[model samples]
Target: MIRSLRGRLFLGLTAIIILTGATGGLLVYRWAFREAAELQDSVLIQLASLAQNGSFSSGRPLLGVEEDTDVWLIELGATPRGPADDRQLFGLKDGLQVVMRKGQPIRLLLRTRPDGSRFAVAQPTAVRDDTAREMAFRTLLPISALIPCLMLVTAIVVAHSLRPMVRLAGNLDARRADDLTPLPQAGTPSELHPFIHSINGLLVRVGLLVDQQRRFVADAAHELRTPITALSLQAENLGSVDLPEEARGRVAALKQGMQRTKHLLEQLLALARYEAAPAERGEMPLIALDSAVKQVVADLLPQALDRGIDLGFQLVEPHMVRGEPVMLATMVRNLLDNALRLTPRAGRIDIGIYRQDEAAILQIEDTGPGIASPDLERIFEPFFRGSSPEGDGSGLGLSIVKRVVEGLAGEIALENITGSDRSGLRVTVRLPLAADRPNEVSGAA
Candidate 1:
């Protein structure tokens, strides 16, 4: 319920100080009062002893004594009171303590003279108690007064300590809704620097992704608009056709164009969906890697055979992983399709699935001209197609594979596995093993 951080900090600090001060003050007051009472009693007893030794001789108390010393004299006017009571001597002192009444504490020295006379010197207990109380109050007053000052200083320190958070909040508040600029701060404490740097890095990534989305939408609209308009124009032209052979040929060409346009549109939609989905969905089901790989290989075998390319599976295990089956299938299908599309006639393509420690490994190797090392990294980027003799491609296959791999918390690597007899490319996909599986047969089982 204590929302204001500074307020809470000040209160906590003040509470600690007050408790410590009260405890120390209580201890000092008790010790000082006890010592002062002892000093008073010792003075009273010593004075009484000296008086009894004839130190106070005549009618007066003492020689050269200050006028402040009040010594009471009591002569035995009539000694017929009773048997000498020792208790009476105990209370009687060398000095008068007239102000200290019955039941009131007093410090007094009492002496019984040789002639059955008594003399006493006394001071009230109130004197020592009052002095002790006054000293304690004096010490406590300044500390109590300084509490407010201490609170102010504490508040300032807390504010300075939290200045970075305040600045970050202010920056966020001032930013535009669409602004994804990195937060700017300098001289921030080291403890908070990592948080600030993380935020800045996130902003940079989100900003680039937003920029990419904007460009993708614009380009998609532009790309689809032409084909859509062409289809509409062809539909319109069809109604006005008159000749036989010539008109039929025109119709066929227009139909082909429409099909191409439709295919392009579908690919664009798929790419958009791949990009727009949440980076991580709630949870994925466990899918068998062998089954997924074999399905993909089977679906692409016809295409591979059409080009005289050999395609087969080399699975070491039916590795199971947590993944969206459709997405996993898409990734495998794209990798195989990419290989089959580029591999020359009589080339060999190998697909394998197995568990490797805590990961599921899917490796695809194709006997195609290996990607030049410089272009390997760029091949997975959207709309990137390397120098392959095969004609135009939509360039989204490897990109889709990369996106799906990342979405499933997996990794893929491409390397040249070319040999003396064949030049080829190798792709390795590694997905994190399911949490329920203890030891994967691949390694460290």
Candidate 2:
């Protein structure tokens, strides 16, 4: 499991302070101990020198002599023979531990006279004990008191450094689900800005998808309810039909309306699926524009012939685009289907492919009751109905066309081809040119 950033930072900062304090403490201790030993050695050497050179006030032998008080000096022969003599000589030194029967640890200073006789002066360990203790206490005691203060300061610094992250976390925790706005992190560290920016991007995308879903659901319900209610009414009417030609015609019209409603619902479902995907639309068939258009026209030609409309193509060039063949075909079929259904008998409809400015353009123009200027853009929205001669459409057709064009990174635009009365609807589609195709005609015999 991942630990929080604040906790990790605090731990790391505290550890650094601890290491620094430990290193400083070790150095201080070493310096204090070495200085103590040096001071003791200097003081003892000086006292020993004074003892060797100076004489007593009485001018007699101060060393190896007894005194009225315990404060007296002692001088011992380097090679003493008897225990009694050594015990008597040991009493001369004041407050010194001297074992005359063995070697003693004392700082000795030697003085030489003109007669070449040597006198030795010694200060025993007790002479400098109190001074050494005082020096050690003075040097090391303050450092011992500083450790706690250092720890407190380290903790404070760590807390201060992590306060921003704490606030950021709290801000995030208190947010509502509908909050798509960015987190209010004005003073955030540079190290975390990329993460913040990435999250904001995610929020934007998710918000868009959520809005789209809401619209889809609302529109689907509104469109589906009308047909379902009509069907229910039709079923009621079925029980009361004492059939004449007029009654049968009403039933036939009702059945056709039901079929149209079902078709519209299916189309809406497809549009929803296409919009809900989070990733790129997957690969589709490599279809030639001419062939795909020709096929759709072939399928719908019978209806056109029945309406006495002349549906023809202008293949200025053969161009191919990458798309889901089914979706692309649907898009073309819907556009042409709307045109054929709306155009009056003897109306001429043109399907043409041409290139302009390095893009493949498919133009579908029909001399039918063209869309009004205001309704051109609105017609592409789902379930929209235009005041025209054609039967009411599922309204998903144009929307499906738009979705397919966007999925393939293409564009669509409509213009009124009529001279003055807004009588012809012209739709132009532009697709990107293929980049990795061989320079030869494809699917050519």
Candidate 3:
């Protein structure tokens, strides 16, 4: 019923150790018991031999022997003549025998001398058996001690043997959602090779499926571009042909809708293209990041002016980073456009680009309302406008920017700017600096 492999292995090994120890201990205990009994019998024989040779008198306790064994001398005359105990002992033949002395059983050795008198060496049966059991019991102490030690060793070995599998799971959990890299098989145990191979095959299949989905979106967007453009043209033509005032207003609305549709198509194409990695990364040029950012700002500057919002760079540093110029431009433009949509008239938008650590940092701060705390976690997800969406803006801008940043091997973070005087959103991006870029900092403007 145990579900954990470690628990099951430990339990099984513990059971095996206990069973083996019990069997071995039982065998050794029986052997020790038999040997102890034989040794006691030999002691009695030696005592009888010594008693006959020595000058010991009748009913005298042996001086040189152990008292706990209750071995002593008993003199019975050549013929049985004393109490029931002595007479019974004298009735025995030579050598060791179990006999009753006064109704109590004793281990006795009877011998007859050359003078035709007899003597017996005797020990109580209970005393002899108890001494033998004590010796045999001592032999089992070591095995009893080893059982717990073996169980401890088994637990440690089970955890050690499974550490690699636990580490593999942690690595998988930490991977990015878009990452489909195959699990590595080298340096792993041979037993795990089959498992890793199966996971790698799964990753390959998932990657192919993702690629197919991206291509489908890209192709669909490409096919729809022409018709959306024609619709926009027709709407523009209608705007110019004056009609009833209500008809003019309707034409303007139709033109706006067409513009939005065109924008959505362009965003879909950008997302699909940037989401897939470039076919040849080496073909990308290492362009100046500051220069590319400035171009994007210039293109969006007129839009900011119409809204009466301030947009300009606060700091710029010369740095090179590898990426397509169009891709990078799209990334910046989408971000700025999102800010412009949410920023009220006369709001401030600041842009800064510089080198920090091993990365080129592009930070943008807007004086608009920051996103809802609940929405921050999923803000980059496609079509997820916040619960309190400020305008009729498509929610694809941040998603597109995220894809472009990932394609450039960069990280993007959005924090709610909190202060006593103001509150808004601060978006920071960190891209790996190209190897050939300059690292010197420039004075802030």
Best by TM-score: 3
Q: Which segments of candidate 3 are over 4 A away from where they belong?
A: 55-88, 92-134, 167-171, 181-194, 243-249, 277-284, 437-445
Worst 10 residues of 1 by lDDT: 74-83
For candidate 2, give the lDDT of residue 391. Answer: 80
Q: Which pairs of residues have clashing backbones in candidate 3?
A: none
What's each prediction's TM-score?
0.47, 0.48, 0.82
Predict model 3's lDDT versus the native. 0.86
Query: Against the unseen true structure, what C-alpha lDDT does each candidate score?
Result: 0.69, 0.66, 0.86
The local distance difference test score of model 2 is: 0.66
- Residues 1-445, candidate 3, lDDT per residue (tens digit)? 8999899999999999999999999999999999998999999888888887747766767878778888878888789898977886777789888887777788888889888899988888888889989998999999999999999999999999999899899989988778899999877788999999999999999999999999998999999999999988988888668599999988888888888888999999888877766643456667788888888788889999999999998999988788787788888888898888888999999999988999999999999999999999999999999989977677899988887787787999999999999988999999988766344322111
Ranking of candidates on TM-score, top first: 3, 2, 1
Per-residue lDDT for 54-142 in model 2, tens only? 45322133444333211222344443334673445433443323333235444433433344333344444444444455665676566
State model 1's lDDT: 0.69
Candidate 1: where are CA atoms >4 Å away?
A: 1-263, 279-282, 435-445
